[model samples]
Target: MRRAPWIRLLLWHASAAIPVLGAAAAFYGPALERTGGAWPAPLDDVYIHFGFARAAALGHPFSWIPENGYSSGGTSLTYPLALAPGYLLGFRGAWLGLFAALLACAALLDLCRSLRRLLEPRGGPGAASSRWVGWVGWLAPLFVVAVPLLDWSWFSGMEVALLGAVLGRALVAVRRAELAPPARRPAEQLRAGLLAALLVATRPEAIALAAPLAVAVAHAAGSLGAAASLARASLPTALLLGAQAAANRAFTGEWGAAGAVRKLLLSNPYPTPLEKAVEVIKNLAALRVQALESALGGPWLSLVLPLLGAVAALDRRSRRVAVPLLLGAYGSLLLVALNATARYQNLRYAAPSLAMLLLAAALGAEALARRGRLAAGVAAALAVAALAAPSAGFARQIDHFARASANIAGQHVEVARRIAARAPRRVLLGDAGAIPYLSGIPAIDGLGLGGYRGMPFARASVHGVPAVVELIERLDPAERPDVFALYPSWWGGLADVFGRRVDAVKIDDNVMCAADEKVIYEADWSALAPPGERRAGVIDEVDIADLMDERAHGYAFPSPRGGWVIGAVLPGGGDGAGGGGGAGGGGAPRFDAGRLIPEGREQSFTIDAAAAIARGPAVLALRTDGGGPIALGVAALRDAGGEARVEVPERPAGRWSEIRVPLRDVAPGDRIRIRSLLGTFRSFHVWLLRP
Candidate 1:
């Protein structure tokens, strides 16, 4: 009359999958209906993976758009690879989301089975015979699937669910190895290593979990020396991680993926190390606060359950499992908090970590229940209350998900349709995901996620509009996007300079979009050559504002000083405090982009001025923001060195001006350096001209 072990296992997995599927249906049903049966993901980022998958399916792995040639934009390399098979098998469009959903559900089922195994006793008589234990195991999965954020992540068409599943399996494998006899530990260790590698491939942050789990596995393999054991347990992970880095380097010219370079604070071009450290600390604090508030059933239960789980780790019998679980859970949370985007998108980055903590809490509850009938009752009450606490938020999460999906469908998808109808060559846009995928148009990501040579764009965007303009101006002209679809508010300067508005799409009641409106424009590059008098004797021009140009000119922020950072002056003089011929005044400056040379700091550029030297009466022309005066130092060093300084007077604030400093006996390899004698000022362009 007793159910078979396999039957119970099957039932538990089925039970766990029911809520996940039900939640998916409840969330996606209204969204699909709202979009008129068109599938739209809750996040635009979902379509990013679809784009990569489609490229991979067409035999171009790692490329977001096949023509873009090798992009490391997809964060989860394995997820797109997983979805690629679906694309090959004819699961296109709406069916793609369904395919992803099935994969997530399968992962959830696997996670449930792993959790149930972790909940059960290792090996002994009557260990598997307890009815209460079986019921608790069944309820644990329900608790996991019931958390609103986890459910949101599972159905969001991202890699969160698969990550959880792989992480759970890896933990189970580590635990099994710990409990195995010495003779059997090596095989278990190898299995754990393989799963850990897969975990990293699924999500690179899984390295935090995998590293601690490796240490735990090594501790268990006592007969093998610690170094050998650690190597054995960690070998697969290191190799896989190394291979990913090598592949990224080979294709993208970066060791890290484009997503990491664009999103992580560590990779950002911070002017100072101290500033980077401060920003990182702030991000970590913010993520922790968010987790405490919304990660569990509110702050109190969130604090209590994890504490109880830590308490359960005191017992030697439970220490083996509890220690590793605790480390992996908290470690994963710490790792994700370092990301700039961790606090956004409903904390999707932290979902896998929360699941691990919840599972650990469930185990702790089971441990408490084993003490006495009173303890068991108390544990049962707490567990049920924790599960019920998230119910209020569950409905809200579902509504948000559906509404977010609707927003993407109405805005990005509609824009894509319009764009496809136009069929322009090489579109440029900030939101790069759904539009590029759905439209089948070759596009450049203005935000740099999926663009060709996107890093410069990413850095330029961070600095401001002037930097973006300088970079765009330097482009080969043929490579510039002919059409642009962008949120005008996000790129007003760029739009004004190069885009002629064609159409716009607006979405209302939006919960998840960068802006309310996305405007389409025909790119007008004529602005690159603004109508102005050409300087007749100009021999060389260097755009000091552009990072690429700065490097090419051997530009350097002088030693023992704070480095200069890229800054921009918008047309109309930014905030509009009028002075002289600045944009805020009666007229706009010819150039509005430059690098900010801080007060009392010098910036130097090496110029090969051989032609200017050969031409009689050569001069150096400097274009600078008119707010402050500057001192120019010229050093001529062909074989011997001679130096001279020239001072320029300041003009009105919020304006730009050109000052021509005559050069006497200037040689071929002369170095030009400028220092702000007054307050910080922007250096727009430097030109060597023959008078």
Candidate 2:
């Protein structure tokens, strides 16, 4: 006897859950054994969500650390809120990750059920009631559960499974709306809207899928008109997304969340629009290639799946469903392409899109089965062939997940525990995941994913150490970090500038940590002395190495012909001791960092001489890295008049040299222009001194 529908649904879920749960066991077994039974999340980023969930459970949503006011760092506002209940129920420490895994498992089961319903034949006079149809329904869910990458995502303690489930549910709702009668269309559209809202709240990129689904709903409205249906289908998502933007702006002073700002290529600074476009295209192309090899099961599946989707779309009966699914799959891939980290963590970013493509392929299989028994057999054979490679590699993926989890445990978690033992007031670090979450210590994310100064810190880190030093010096004393834990290779210059190494964590056979070693440093801020405490006759001092500071002083390289390199450090060491030389002094210049201006380039700085003790003639002192004897053409412009050009003769090479340009008729609000007429040299410090 055939099973009842509910019983069959239960069986489908059971089949899906079996592999999922078994995979979870296989992944966690080795991870726990390696970490001495301390459960470690496969990726350090999972702890970031845990931190946000802990804050939310404590009545402070949107905060990374409850003590720190508000942080828009959590990527998914709803994921953390969903996990908050676990925290409230005392799922602390490793249990919280288990709770997340359980949530993901439940989501995977729901996704499987949704896919079965989506692929099942609808009731009609000639609808296929063949035994093969039932088998297809049973196998579709199993096929989804079988993909190694998707299974890895399901157990990774991230939101990938939840996103897939919500997207699946939304697709089903939209499909129902497409088939429903005009009288019931609005209600189904509303249902889809609510699900889309949930999807967007889970991951903002769901708009890629949700958008086309909204259009599908509007198309289904037919003669009834699209406005009402479109509104019903789009309202919830619009409101949720708008509220999220508002909250982000109110808390973090940015319209986008901290995590997105830190990671998206769109958020990075580009010198020109052409450069940005070229880089984004290059990145997307590379990501698509990677997705084909891994995320889409294999390169062969990439070709076969799209061909199947096209076949389904060409079929008169399946065209409506196939078109929307194709659009959604393409959109999802495009969304993943925009992500800077799309290639990392086993291509987790592409998992949702993979689900979409698989669903479309399932539809194509059903369309083939509708033709004849022989065609049905052919479709079944194709399905097996498509899945063969991914299924074969499942064990290897499981091993990778286990080792990655162990890596996080041995590196990030171990370091966090050690730092926690110190009881430091505030810790600063680049990898802002496990340390803040596991240690429960306040933190400043040097990469800016979990802090209020996200934009400045992110931009400074990209510009290199001199800009970072300037940013650190600008911070209030209270906000400055006391303990620094960072990868020496990643932030070596920063380590040299403001840190004294006190401890280190080294891990072996590391597959996922940024580096094998994470060094802990005690901060040393003595080198950043105030300008007033420096030299007696100094009127104004400009550190040309600091990009933002230089920009603030109207510093620029005017010609496209000559390139400028910011934060250029000289090879020879200077202690960064302040105030060692004046216009004619022989003492070595203390500054060791500068901007390297190429030959024939003009560099200009506008100084407010009103701040000087007396606005008379001043000595323009240039501390430059010694390469060769250099000649510079210097001109001064004042509100009253312009001064004659002064030529600065080349000094000795192979060391740091101070070249003095005497300014005549200097007054308040004067602008100085300096150009390298002969040699390409780095200018370390520019000073205006009382003559």
Candidate 3:
């Protein structure tokens, strides 16, 4: 039996995927160990996510405390947020997020090559198709592994990248199997269905991948086999879906609104899914520029790929895979919208389609050009290089994982711990959910995305400040709660809300918990500040939250020119911070640009002088909304020009941190405006304030 050159070619390319995988493994080796980090509720939330999923598997209530011990945010329903939990369980908490990312990259390359294989045999230079797979495999490690390491903080635990790979591979499998016999095609189609289902299970919106797979499935089905094929192919998908449905039913008690799908399954006034999709698209388009920047390491590179992808799709040779490729790309882009953190999403989100399209572009380039070898070689080199650099970085970081745990070891978690310890068993706090979940303290709401939906977040009975005060008054008599950790936003009529029962205490600094007041004040907040570190210097910096982007590591607010984020809007938004966190980033008239405000709207900044300035800039510094996409940055007045937008390292939206700039250049009476960097020129989209 003579072996075909193509099979050997594919096998060789597949075999070559090892070093690329190994390289990726080497770079992100550190994350493979610990689960929790100093960051927000992503990985830990995943722990909570898996806890609920595993609980569903075992038939337990969705509670982070599991048995006892208070926590906040119960039973979060967002399954995509929980995918890491499955990996943690399977990988034994190896933090295989990086691995998933690498796999996704590889999968995209595979998608390109397989599609090439199908197209080449017909008219696209079929025999030479096998060689292209190697380059695709080469890119797997590059984009997935290396690029993410450029910034140590962009570690989103590899969920997006990995799931993307699974999606791309599934598409590739569908593409490769498209030419299968009518008799055997049913099985191939079923495989595609299973792949699509897995993707949906990993991420709720991932059902977008199904559109392209459906195209591929329909393409493969014979006229006579259409009815039977749809049935056969859709069965495995149905089974997986059923499994998710049962899990959803177990937790949420409804089949349609099961698992993480519950969030999407609900009836909304937005009407049809298309409307929801429209809303999602609106949000995505707002961050398109930023998403591109985040993906490419800078803003300009982000612009090139999509533009190039669009161009490639238009090519005559690429027409076959172009529509599906574009659909996948558009679908992938949706993941960045209307949720949180659009920055890094631009990078990971487009990987599946981008990777595929690039490969397809490369394949098309090869098929159409006399310099196919040179063209493919260059493309392959860049792809391999992208994979290699990160793999190298991972090797360097692996040794630091253990050190990372010990170095900062539970420093931040301790805050949540002490407050929970001092408070009563069932006490509630503003951020009780996250604080307790991280510190293992039992606070009010412990559920995250999934569990939190069903939990009591707000009650109509306790809506107003006076009503809240009354609820607090009632609590002592019945709920018997002790401490109250009030976030400033809730601090509103809360005292009035709690009636005479809850006492709203304003701590002088950021430190809290009476138990460690001395240490918290002396050591925690103030102690970290350098001597004379209180100047108005952070003004020159850029804030990405202005762009509705949340994927930042930490903010670098220079000397305290202003200590607090002053909530201010131009005189036109109806005076004061009345609109806080409502339409335009709640109060700023920006922040929520795409949703609540129009594009290209511009307004001025104004602040009240007789108000509570918090002794310095602590109260004067304008705080932006953390609700919209992150990267919501603050741009200080400089050069009398308000055209620059930069990514803010910090994304703490609720807390007021000062932004100080050298006022030497501008006169004392100059009117300065600080608006959200969110991409909207609309006056509504721009938050305006003058301090």
Candidate 4:
């Protein structure tokens, strides 16, 4: 290692980091990490992507029409970034992920060049230390930019790393000019101004790099050719804005302003913008500690570091340059009161900012190093550690996703094969995160998740029995899928909606809720005697004493929507607080399941959906041992699908009876599944002819 040269060092860096980067990119880095796929809630961020792919293949215009739950309301800024690239490349998240990784790597290499120059022997004014320059060259970028957020740069979509590279090059040009002979300064200025202008194209903030950059470039040109230099620098910004203006003028009535944004950041309900900005501006003692933690990722804690670093960067030339850069960064991050205000600068958001700040800090650290290598090492360590902190969690997080993806990928492949074998013609999917991409079937956006706020998707029950049934009812016949590939989450949530006639023919620990009598069961099992019985007159053998029937017919009782309820029914006591009772004083309902029923999605459960109806009437019918199909309510597990069986102990045997179920029941046309908190669960079964 001691004999290792620059190439060797570079290779070492690549060897150690690339595998980690590749794993992250493949699993969590879908669309380069910005779209969080490696998490439990992967679908929420990039729902529209899968929808757009199949939609285009079918010749549907990539029109403003959005069926995914994404609101296509105003000029949603998350668009161009969110939708445009997918549309342009005819690609989806995974495809984009591959592209993002390459682009970012290229940009990072260029940034390394700028960093090397800043740290080179061209010492600052009054500081002519050759050793200092050498140290600066190597440590500036390593400590400042790349190491801090290098990991993050690999995954984010919309080219943040590329923008970072451009910024790095221009800043390097500035530092290079600072040391150039008086005669060569003008040439340096032109390089800086030109690079700055080009960077503006990557992000809206790049435009601000213009004014100061133009003057700086002209200064490098040696003459007061500031007018011409500024003109040239301004050209890119003008043309870009001009094109937007022309399009905006042609389409809507606004000038270049994208007027689609309507709400203020204060209202978003997450880490409010006011709180975040205050956090960024007030890196006082206590807040400073907090910012340090965010350097790893608290509501984007890392983002504030850049602003604080910019505020703290000293030295005359640095002050001049950092002021404009900081202004533009802050303005771009917080200027929009109503834009798609992404917390782009949180701790992880701080990665690039840290990179930029490192350039200046390297210059400063070199001076400090003169006191002693110890002082310089301490300074660099602090900066580098702060930047690398948030990325640490990413390491743990990436593996968790990689393993999960490996499992899910297998499920997706099997699910796709099953769907292709069964439903061949256009398949409809529920919770379509990676499935549609894995399967080649033309897909319909299930929940409109990608465009959660404005994308138009028919909201139905979750992915369970009822949701599947409801979904089937809502889809067009052409798009009406016979085979439904559902995430266990969706299926589990809506499993109770259909009863229990659901099955797992295609995959184990998985289900196939269909209506085909040949090889499939239906999602709609409401008319079935029991929730999961395939045959009528089947008998489950659990203790089923009190059954609630106040709401009548279905699982509804405590008002609102007629749905299921769960709680420990107080034995011999009557239903309390919005509950009705049956013969054994057990027909009411209580207990908040800690979940709410949102519009567009059904709310069902896999537990014993109990209710106490009047014993004198039909209250104690299938108390515990009604393994046999009862007259009106839910049936035993046998007749419904999934070979589901509910054990009704000798009804009226014990004061309180517990109904034990073996299989899940479901509704017709639904495919969602459900489970209990303990992971131990049984789906509902439906008996078509009242058992």
- Tens-digit per-residue lDDT, 537-636, candidate 3: 2222222212111112122211111111212222122212311222212222221111222222222332223333232221123333333332222333
Worst 10 residues of 3 by lDDT: 518-527
TM-score of 3: 0.50
| Candidate 2 lowest-lDDT run of ten | 570-579
TM-score sort, best first: 1, 2, 3, 4
lDDT of 2 by residue, 312-423 (tens): 7777666666777788777877766666777677777777766767777777877777777888888787667666656766777778887888889888988899999998
**How high is the lDDT of residue 233 in model 4?**
47
Q: What does the lDDT come to for candidate 2?
A: 0.72
Model 2: per-residue Cα lDDT at residue 174: 84
List candidate 2 stretches off by more than 4 Å. Answer: 124-132, 231-256, 265-290, 294-302, 315-321, 338-340, 453-455, 530-594, 599-691
lDDT of each: 0.72, 0.72, 0.38, 0.39
Each prediction's total of clashing residue pairs, residues at least 3 apart in sequence or on different chains, is 0, 0, 107, 138
C-alpha TM-scores of all predictions? 0.86, 0.83, 0.50, 0.45
Residues 1-691 of candidate 4 have per-residue lDDT tens digits of: 3334577458545643454345344545442232234322122123233344334434432322233322222222222343344446655434644444455556665666655555444343225555433444454434433332334433443345666677778777766655567677656655665666566544454555555555544544445355665565455557756775665444433243322222233322234456645644443322233323443455554543453344334544454455555555544433332233233222333333434444444445544454456765664555555445566565544444343333443344345556555545544454444445545555554543322222123222221133324333334444444445554444443333332334343323211122111122234322212222222222211111011111113331111331232212223322211112322323332111112222222323222233222111111122211122221223322223432222222234223323322223323322222222221121122112112
Candidate 2: which pairs clash? none
Error of 4 at 631 (Å): 48
Strongest candidate by TM-score: 1
